[model samples]
Target: MAGTIALPLEEFIASLDNASLPKILQVCSGVYFQGSVYEISGSEVCFSTGDLIKVIRIELLSVSCEDVRKNDKFELPINHTGLFKVVPDEMPYSSIEELLSLRPVGLESSLPFTFSSHSKMTFGTLTLGPGRALTVLSIERHKGEEDQVRCHVKGQQEASAEVRIPLSSRGEFYECGSEECFTLQEIMSSPSLRSRRFHFINTTKYEQPLVLSPVYQVHAIMNLRKNVLKFPSNLEVDVVDVTEQCKDADFVNPLSLTEVLSQPDESFPAVVEILECPETRSLFKCSWLPELNKNQHLVFHKKGTTAMVLLSSLKSRKTQQYFLVSQQYGGRLRRRPREFNSVYELYAASTRTPGLKVSVTRNCEEVEEEGLPALSVGDQLEIVSCTRMELLCESSKGNKQSVEALLCQHLSDPNDVDDDDDDDDDGDEEVKEQDEKTEVLLPLYMQGHFVEILSDNKKYRLSDLEKEFSLPLDVKVVSRDTGLELDPLVGAACLRIEASMLEPTIQASFPHRPDYCFEIPTQWLSLSVSFTKHPLPWPQGQPPKCNIERVTEVTDVFFYEFRIRGNTDEAPPPRPPKRDLSSLSVTKKSSKSEKKSSKTSKAKNKQKSVPTDQFSALTLNNKKRPPAPPPPDGLNDEPPPLAPRKLSEAETATRKAQPNTYVKMEQSIKNDLYDMSADVDSDHDYESMDESLVSMVKTAQEHIVFY
Candidate 1:
């Protein structure tokens, strides 16, 4: 693979060793030289090739072949060796002779070398490297007149192996050059080298002058097998189908098959984003046809300009009318290299299939009724005028005849029609004939016509006109050209539907009032109530009474006498269905009902316990009551009933007596504890006194005559 070697001028020069003394190197810029580096000075590098001496600045010697391994295998340097194809350059060549006259020029010498041509083709064997060479056969053509006569390398075959070459001017002249064209712009600026081909010739001596043979001409060559430098190269563009994930890309709106045919002239924004490698490149803005099954072609163009055009069409089977259009961006030019403005337009007719006409505009105007030009599918027409008309004539015939016929009909004669079955058959036949005559001869008019209806807008039908006139209408033919309203009947008049109905009156019941309205009916209003604990001695007065405040009333407070029906019961008004309460219950329904009953009983007991109009003070005593004995064993199973809140006078006295007995028992226990403590103190004192008397007697006897 051929590639680019980019490094500092000094480092590339430093990679050279004794064995790699004879090497081809390039300067950074400002000078062109492809010679062996003879000597390296502090600020200069010298190059020579027998009678040729080129001294380059140290800074200018930027690019060099540093690959110096003797045993390393090297493939073709695709970038340097013009062994690739040559495509039509932006510069146009008119004839085959002009294109074939192109010659390869050296960067340093600007020396021109022409290819040896035979049978209108330049055939040469390219020596790729040592023991590796291929024959390059190319031809020039004056095809595609836009950029005429392109140079193309037809093919490459092993030089040692025999391969046949066709001499005829036919088949595809492989497209090249546009993408494979190589230049030495990176290393040098002046005396640029560009060739139509390249061949490598291995020389043992550095001073040997490079020459070409009658079979092969050297465009440019690098001995990669003996260089330490490896250049980066681009792989050939591989055309593959877009991945299944990208088949329906999320970013781009592809043209559907129906849209391609129906909306041929419409231009849709072509935006596609590849989510897989999103950061690598910006959005791909290119036109696409959804109807085309082929995926987008991805080209990796490292250098130069590229342009792509795709044409797609759809045709009608019966009419042979089609929508032919080509979508593409302008090819890259010096002024606009990467153009984003893609152009697409429908063709007047299909060039591929004869007799196929393409329609660009969708609006088809009437030629007969509007007195416009007759237009075929591909005819171009411009809008003259557009206006709104309440009534549009449907039939091509004149409108005056239809209006006159309507006015002649007698609307009052329907009541006198025959009711007999025998006459019905005759009447039907007469009605059918009259209908056919009116349809075939007179112009039919559409009274109501509009794309959209806005507020306060109105449309009227024929039925409305009949209803306005009670008797049969007697219209005198009025000329719109003269701007006259002529009617023969005395009470006859013309009136618009909007004029007759000043304001629309709907017959349905009133809708719910808006939230902003304060006068919303009481039934429409939602009321909520909350209860709070009242303070003690709450507004002491004669009696507590509930009061109702009259906030607002629509009518004067009217006192109406009501006669209640004693036999019938008024049905309750419907209520909104309540939310399910089953989830709220912790226990089963049976247990829940028992709990509710118990709560209700407790509420009743509490109400009865308190005096309705009086306050009862609570008094607590400090005396402790005697602990009650444990309930009998079997009685423990049943819980004791709660005592009444208010106790009778006798029961209260008895309860009070129970506390007195407990106090007495407590006092007796304290007296017995005191008596025991006194007896223990008296015994302890008597023992001590007795011990003291004995000690005193012992001391007196011991002092007298114990000796």
Candidate 2:
């Protein structure tokens, strides 16, 4: 065999110097130099061959995610596609290029609105965007335009109730930068939505196809940020699936394919494209459809500017767009260098050697990390991701027995090590064999674990935050400690997740011990529960009650643990499912039934000891039981078992069949996890501490998923 071979899982892992890959991808060249308005002031940017710059590109790799829509008072108009995606008629839906940036000339509202120099404006979503508050959209001034535009406005939330209008009827707003734009001053003064819609006119011209969310759409508008001409070298995605868009990427035989095509060949030579990989500069004849016209759309994203720039080559010229690159900073013109030497140092460094692996990770689950409320088993955690993770375990052909043995390790009773990386060496061995020689191992992070809300000063935690999320998660402290208050972390947890990370080697049977606190400081206000599955939908009109129970389990090994914090005065509130428009999103809510359907039962069958309930009656045996229906969204727990409000015969039919409709639209993709059992635990009654932890792990499993 001439091809490379994969080593056994143990041997591969053991051979590594470091188990983890690098966080930063290869340093790149062709940096799009940036000019700052305030920071650089009079400075200028100049690009030179071989020069280097750092950039950050924000990339989202998810195929789908859940969004919630809260109905103000009515149920039908609940805006469930997520406020971010809603581009009301007031502001037409736009790409980041057109919706949210502002220019430095300062709001010269006096000038007439005309196309001239690149015009930048600010776009802030009124309580709708996903980021803290808003986003800024800017328009690059076209070559022949003149005039500054000013926008006075009202806040960007729903117009007053008077604006009684369905989004579809309203259509899209004009794509004018200011004619239909808003300013902080104006936004705060807009009229009622009902009156606004009723009085406002409707036009059919702007109706464009409702497209799926763009791969990268600026979510919110924050501040009057200038545009960035460059992009960071890497676009982050926790997982990726770049399965060669071409049939024979490396086998570029133009003549061979052309000859076949001329003589009745099936290779479809017309589809072959001679294109360059932006990251890897080598020419690749890919399988991309010729109609894509990717080459014409010259877009470059640089780190400094939190926006993507159009590297539009002058249309007048025949060369590829951006055939020549330049740099500019702060308005002052940096003199261009005389020599056109090769910019190959960093460029060549980015080229990949065979077998090299590079990738990025992100936390997409609604699960909590720090202030998330701890979860008990019986809770289902569904973490969906589009990451393409590879299993480097030994091949069944050669190490079938060893692979089985390795899997068994996860099931063994707790063999706890003191620190979080107790098995660092062991795990590293597997990674060593897997990662490439030059791969940078970015820091590995854990996301989506549930945690009890400690306090609620609103932590809009995006490891990398922007202005859109700039909702004043501001601070206001009335500290009793008077003197030594740190960053005044509002919803700060007294005990952090990292603290227990590598806690002293937990003894056997306590791998997932629960750390309980009976009483806590009153400073923590919002006792919000966070889910790695869905933004917790705990019922409202109630506080929380700590119902701590400990149980022993059959398995001696430990898996995970949670620290529960609760208030005795509060009672567990009722939970209602949040609505999601299935046509647009996969509803987040599924029932926690007292019974199991054939499918849930099939998955449940593996757990021989699970307690059965009314749902079990529906569980079918073999013969491909009609695919069990999916659970319903917006479902209320059969309204308090006792004196439950009975449903009418018609209402009952609607409830039962709705879920099956949803399941047809969505399918969960399974990731080959190292310890599949740990993420899933049964919420069975336990005898002691060991059982409680085991059960927690099992419950955690429902939420656990590998990306």
Model 2: residue 639 alpha-carbon error in angstroms? 71
Instruction: Estimate the overall C-alpha local distance difference test score of candidate 2.
Output: 0.23
Model 1: per-residue Cα lDDT over 1-707, one tens digit each: 11134343333433323343233333323222344332222223332221111111122212222222332223322134322223333354343334334433331232111222322332356312222212233332345532222222223462243322333423222212332323333223322122222222343322221111111111111222111112211111111112232323222222222222233222211111111111211111112112112222111101111111111111224221111111111111111001111001011111211222122222334433322222223222111121222222434233411121100111122333456766478776687456433311111121111111112223322234334432111121122211112211112122111111111110111112111111111121221111112221223332222111101111111101011211237433222222225533544676889999999999877855643211111112324433433332223355433333567898988785332222333334344434444666454321122334334433433333211
Off by over 4 Å in 2: 1-106, 109-178, 183-186, 189-520, 523-707
Give candidate 1's TM-score. 0.13
Clash totals for all models, in order? 13, 102
- Residue 235, model 2: lDDT of 21
Give, for candidate 1, the lowest lDDT window spanning 10 residues: 336-345
* Cα error, candidate 1, residue 490 (Å): 54
Q: RMSD to native for every prediction?
A: 42.4, 41.9
Q: Pick the candidate with the highest TM-score.
A: 1
Error of 2 at 237 (Å): 54
Which prediction has the highest lDDT against the true structure?
1
